[model samples]
Target: MDRFIECWNGLDDPRTGNAALHDFHEILAIAMCAVLCGGQGSVDMGLFAKSKEPFLRGFLRLENGVPSHDTFSRLFRMLDTEQFRAAFQRFMAGFSEQCEGVVAIDGKVLRRSFDSASGKSPLHMVAAWGCEQRLVLAQIATDAKSNEITAVPKLLEMLRLKGTIVTADALNCQRAIAQQIVDQGGDYALALKGNQGTLHDDVVLFLDDPASKAITAEPVVEADHGRIETRTATVATDIAWLNKDHHWPGLAAVGKVERLRETAGKTTSQTAYYLLSAPLTPERFNEVVRSHWGVENRLHWRLDVVMNEDQDRSRLGNGPHNLAVLRHMAINVMQKDGEKGSLRGKFKRASWDEAYLARLLSLF
Candidate 1:
């Protein structure tokens, strides 16, 4: 509890005059604990506080009694989202060391956060997920999906990327972004699509030629759920002529992944391209490419499916972004817990067992 208070002590309270009945950190603490126990919104936070007043008072001082639902809602709606995000980063850093291995950067839209009456669009957040740590390193909310190009650089500024490989989808394959990654002492493997126009076309044309002599890795075949899939990776490090023409920053190699899938006896094939700052072997290239999807499969999917993040209707003020950060904090805490169980099971156990919840809180 002292650690939690110290991490969030710098947040400025939005309340003024006599409106500050409950301590700000106390409200945040309650919200975090409630979320870890599967609480969705302000109402759930209030109910959890009232029900767990005794458990909470063991660490917190309830000088003015438990704060009402309105308090939680109002504070969250008015809180500085940037400050809250920074506090979360600091809190997580206090426990977890600098991230290593593949760091996947991606974006997800909070579908239900849109307000029809107010002409508000769904909130879109671009997050950096540390593949090894299985934690959300940092996130920045964008006004729209297209704004991810601008948001990605800002998100990268918040992380320590030295010696890590940062991967992103084709939409984030900008020269400036690639340069920024190298500038931060990290390498990048960004996907390529028509968005890059001539560059993508040139790579495709060159790799399709027989004389390019790109090294190919052994095909990896998998059978699951009545589907059989095969993936073959090809890498080309002899790109001196290509770099001479393009002058791409840190241009060391180009990669191609050919995926063949058979479902219900129908076969389909797809080819994808990538720009890498490092000249990795075909097998290492395959590993890096496959690990990039962990951001979606492990982090985003868990938040949306397990935590019901998309269904949350928090459209007022900074409520949506702030609540999303709380969900990230909950995931980090649960991921760090050594107990053996699925995340859903942990949520159930934590809510039912106060001792287990205390143990989880002590992990950070």
Candidate 2:
């Protein structure tokens, strides 16, 4: 736990005078442990601290005794989100090696974090998830979904993107975002859509042309959950003519993936286009594109379904965003755990077994 303390010790406490009874790092440490063991909000943190006071005191010095739920809530409300996020990044830097492979950037909403009386919308967060590492590299909270365009660049600035391929949905396929990715020594596979205006139109027109005859990969087929799916990836590297017209930054190739799925005898098909900074093989393109969904399937879904994130109603001040960071930290720790079981199982084990919880804390 010394490693964990070293990273978070840099955070400046917002509390002052009599309000600063508990040590900032100790409260943060307790909160981290609570979330890792299935604690949801301030109440859970307080209960967990009280119940596990002995286990907590092994590493933390609770000179002021356990803090109340109100203390946990107030600290998060007043905490500077930017500093907490930076501390989270610092902690992850020490916890893992250099980030590599597909780093998927996406946004998720804290659906219930809005305050009806205060007229606030749900908190929207843009997160960069390292697919190979299965950890959140960095995140930024935006006021709305449309702000993701602005929020994404800020999120990118916090990451070490060298030698990584960043992927994002059509909403984030802006020219500046693409340029930023290339300028940072990273490649991009941004989805193409109508939002790109003429660029999207030209790519679709060219790829759809019969004479284009793009190189196609052997169709991949999979069957599961009472459904059969087939995906075929096609790539066209002869984009010099297109580049001459658009001059997109680092433009090397364009790609198309056609997916056909039959579920309950109902057939559905989707065709997605991409702007690539490098010419990737159809197979490699398939891998990169498929890995992008890991941010949703592995991170977003788990947060909402497994961790009950959306149901959390912490709608005061910085509470929502700060708690979101804690959730990400908990996930990173648990994902790094080598124990053999599902995440849900790990939470149960951690909650019931203090030894196992200590083992997880030691990962940092």
lDDT of 1 at 175: 95
Tens-digit lDDT track of model 2 for 192-232? 99998999999999998978957899999989889998999
Off-target runs (Cα >4 Å) in candidate 1 are none
Please give the RMSD to the true structure for each candidate, in Å: 1.2, 1.2
Worst lDDT 10-window in candidate 1 = 90-99
Candidate 2 all-Cα RMSD: 1.2
lDDT string for model 1 (1-364, tens) is: 7877888866899998777999888898899899999999899999999999999999999799999999999999999998998898888787567879999999999999998998989999999999888888999998799899999999999988898999999999999999999999999999999999999999999888889979999999989899998999999999998899899999899999999999997999999999999999988999899899999988899998899998898889999999999999899899888677899999999999999999888875
Cα error, candidate 1, residue 278 (Å) = 0.3
